[model samples]
Target chain A: MDLRVEFAGLVLKNPIITASGTFGFGLEFSSFGDLKRLGGIVVKGLSLKPREGNAMPRIVETPCGMLNAIGIQNPGVEAFLKDKLPLLPWRETAIIANLYACSVEEFGDLAGVLSGEEGVAALEVNVSCPNVTHGGAAFGQDPAQITKATEAVKKRCGNKPVIVKLSPNVTDIAVCARAAEAGGADALSLINTLLGMAVDIKTRKPVLANVVGGLSGPAIKPVALRCVYQACRAVGIPVVGIGGIASAEDALEFITVGATAVEVGTANFLRPDQSFRIIDDLPRAMLKARAADMAELRGSLVLPGQ
Target chain B: MVVRNCREVKVQSVRFLGTWDEASDFVELTLENPGWESYRPGQFAMLRPKHWGLELPWGRPFSISRLDAETLTVFFQVIGRGTSRLARLNPGDEVVVWGPLGNGFSAPPETPTLLLAGGMGIAPFRGYIENHPTPEFLRLFFAHRVPLANYPYLAMAEKVRAEAMQEHTPEDLPRIIERIRELMDENHGGIALACGPTPFMRTIQEHAVAGGLRAELSLEKSMACGVGACLGCVCKNGEGKHVQVCARGPVFQADAVQL
Candidate 1:
């Protein structure tokens, strides 16, 4: 009853991969569990130039969730390619690097650099950073911007598979998902951290230095499930369901909703070995759900008419 | 990560051992863990209020206040969010505890020691004096407003008794050196160890040099990776050499660290 999954053309051993922002370049967790044991390790978002990120207080804990406005701090694409890439000891897992940009050209430039990298299995093009303050956060909110951003990345990526990460801040996520597919996205990952805030009541100010941040936790589970349900139906490519997937029962929910693969974010910070815990729980969840195999549960989200 | 269960924890009761005004919410918790019989100076522990949701790691670092080899005590000022949350908890509550990490103070047993403390910098000195009791040799305990006469608990033993040495801010380096020279003139040679803020440490080191006293100064700085990977807590020493406060020395030789 164990769930097996494939993302784009890459076959993952399991469906539980740690999400990007939460997992710091995949090396830190090597102490508790073997890196090759789980599915994949999504590296943090990279850009054409290095970034110091937002000021201090980048993260704060709200009721049942966390708001992080880290602003995608990374050591640029050239440095990542030179310094971080060669250090990865990938045996049974895939290394998916997430790319971000303030403009289409920067996104395209990042994709171009990753496309030639030998160890990278795929590219997760990030169109949804919230802390940018200006037009930078616009790409993932509108369908047109999503399509334009995805197309720009796809054009430069050549044969590289692009997974367009969509934000939940939008009104309707399906429209945004369709645009990503139309612009040549190979796959999709849903519900980047939901935007939320925690205020210091006494101080009459926000807890995080950044006034608001992307929220991720068990608190955002229902919204994330709904987003994954919508995006899976809107696009033909694989949907890697993310957001609030901590336990095996949580992973099974995304699998039943038509997610070919799933990512464990925020939970990674809480428990570095959460990928293994979720992966360990999946087989028993499948047995309890009485599912035959991963194929049958892949698209169990059929409509009434269908 | 290796699970070492707590044996007999002494002093189950916690008392607010300092000025408890709401404006400055600092608490010195006396956890009654008789089993906590072993702890080194300069080491810290992370404890959370009992049943606090695991939203954040229950473990936040706190400097040890007093160690009786049976009962472990710690002192912390409520500064930001975590400590504020901790201030709300009461006695008879159990916070998840993970502890005794990183290198502690090198409090070599009383081979003639000179102890210098500033403000709350006196926290770790309690343990050092208890462990290394040297009365015959001269020792100096520098306090802001004569904390010894106020606290009175430290100088109770002859093996560790020391005279109060007061040095006002920035201007009285010469007077401070004269006091140190008078002490060294009498006893076996001792190492000068001071713990205070950056500016306070600089003055102590300067005065120690004028008196020709070999000194070591402990520092307090903002830190993220206390174990030395993040490079977040780097401070430049006199030689322009950068040192990690968490890993290298919360305690540094006065002459070694320019500040």
Candidate 2:
């Protein structure tokens, strides 16, 4: 029944955090469920300057999932701090800032500004956003770039924990995970949507204006779990699992495989109150697994030979 | 009981209300009155077909064409996989719907109201005229390639006193504008509301702006969450702020949007 989890040194009421980009600044969801009930909320991806995002048909539904190329359309960091940050009920739950930029310095600068802000509990550096033309591919694809971005943020982020959200497009996720850990990341969250595209045959054109997008939903759960398993083994830091988590049982799969926390993304689109439903049902799931708390369930996966 | 404002719901009585062609369809659903909010004209709902599993993961937003105490009706063009699957729904099947959402039309009282709908844009006008204090004060102008008989709500439009005109080509838009101009001149103090494709609404907005006539518009966008959280259904207003159509609108003053 005690679902509390200590993720990256932040004690969450539960491990169910609304993933970035999917849950805009958080106030929008307050009407559906009690924000106070959520473990945390990773607000929409933010940057130093506001982004206009992509063109029309930014999203397209695929098999058991969706592809989106929203390109992180956010009001610049200053506007967010001045106009939007004040709107959140900081006392109710953790607020993790999902920061994206075209360069390492931009990431550091944004992290510094957010570090001084009163309510932010952590900073989620987004190096894996597949929708952008610049930083997404530049920083997330190379282990060296991952180390630089994570170290830059850690240096400027004051005492707040820094979580590097890893992209699933890489050839080896463990290499990136180790690099982030070496750079002093308090934790890691995987996997940020996989790169994919869908084409409309009638017009002979891709469904999204950007032509390609990051795939998310139940379709990517197997890929996500595999990545999480690898990343957890590659580093000493905690890993937050995300991808197709729609139920308590699904969340348990990640926790058992060594994810210290889990964030719900596309499922929020299907049902805004899904996290609340998952949280409420975790007790029965725990009973079924015969685990009292998330701690007992974390990293409990057994290997075939060992 | 109606689960008003509770975005997650399951409702039965999924009856296909028949269609004009394979491309257009109507699905009527009934929900208990408790837990749901009574909807206003111009508001919309999000519908999702159950049991399709991952093939259909999200809901599509539709204008609430009609609303009774226990039933809500929506009309959709079977354009994609979700709607195509919805087109096959049979009576007694259950579907998930949530809403009565977004800011709906605000019709000024006792004033003549002109409704300009392009193609399937006629969806919300039914709720407006039926629930109006003076239904006789409503007038409509619909433009679509299909004949009046094929228009989804032709019978309902007739009951509400709609005036129909045939547009043989896109070139007829200019002639249609001329007609709207004449109507505007005749009803000096009337309010105009328009909906349809972006290009269609843009044309109406330009005319309304040029003539200094009061107009409101309903916009359409690709929305993942029919709530504000997804930030996907954004529309730029006169101020350059990206507002969510599902939250701030789906309906906005004609002057309030960039069109």
**DockQ for all models, in order?**
0.14, 0.57
Tens-digit lDDT string for candidate 2 (A1-306): 789999777999999999998888887777678888999999899999898887767888888889998888888888888887788877778989999977778889999889898788899999864335454455788888788888899999999999999998889999999999988899999999988999989999999888988999999999999999999999999999999998889899999999999999998877667778889998998899888899999999989998
Worst lDDT run of 10 residues, candidate 1 chain A, spans A129-138
Per-residue lDDT of model 1, residues B102-150, tens digit only: 4566655546776666656766677666665453443546655333433
Off by over 4 Å in 1: A129-137, A301-306, B1-59, B62-259
lDDT of each: 0.69, 0.82
User: What is the Cα-based lDDT of residue A244 in candidate 1?
Assistant: 82
> Best candidate, lDDT-wise?
2
lDDT of 1 by residue, A1-306 (tens): 445676678878888888886666776455546778778888878888887666556666655666777777677888877887778765468889899887777788888887877788888988885435445556788787778889888888867788999998999999999999999999999889888888878999987677888888777889999999988888889999998876788888888999988898876544445577677778888888778777788878667898
Note the chain A TM-score of all models in turn.
Answer: 0.94, 0.96
Name the lDDT of candidate 2: 0.82
Instruction: Tell me, by TM-score, which candidate is best.
Output: 2
Query: How does model 1 score by TM-score?
Result: 0.70
lDDT of 2 by residue, B174-223 (tens): 88777867776666678888888887788778878878888899998768
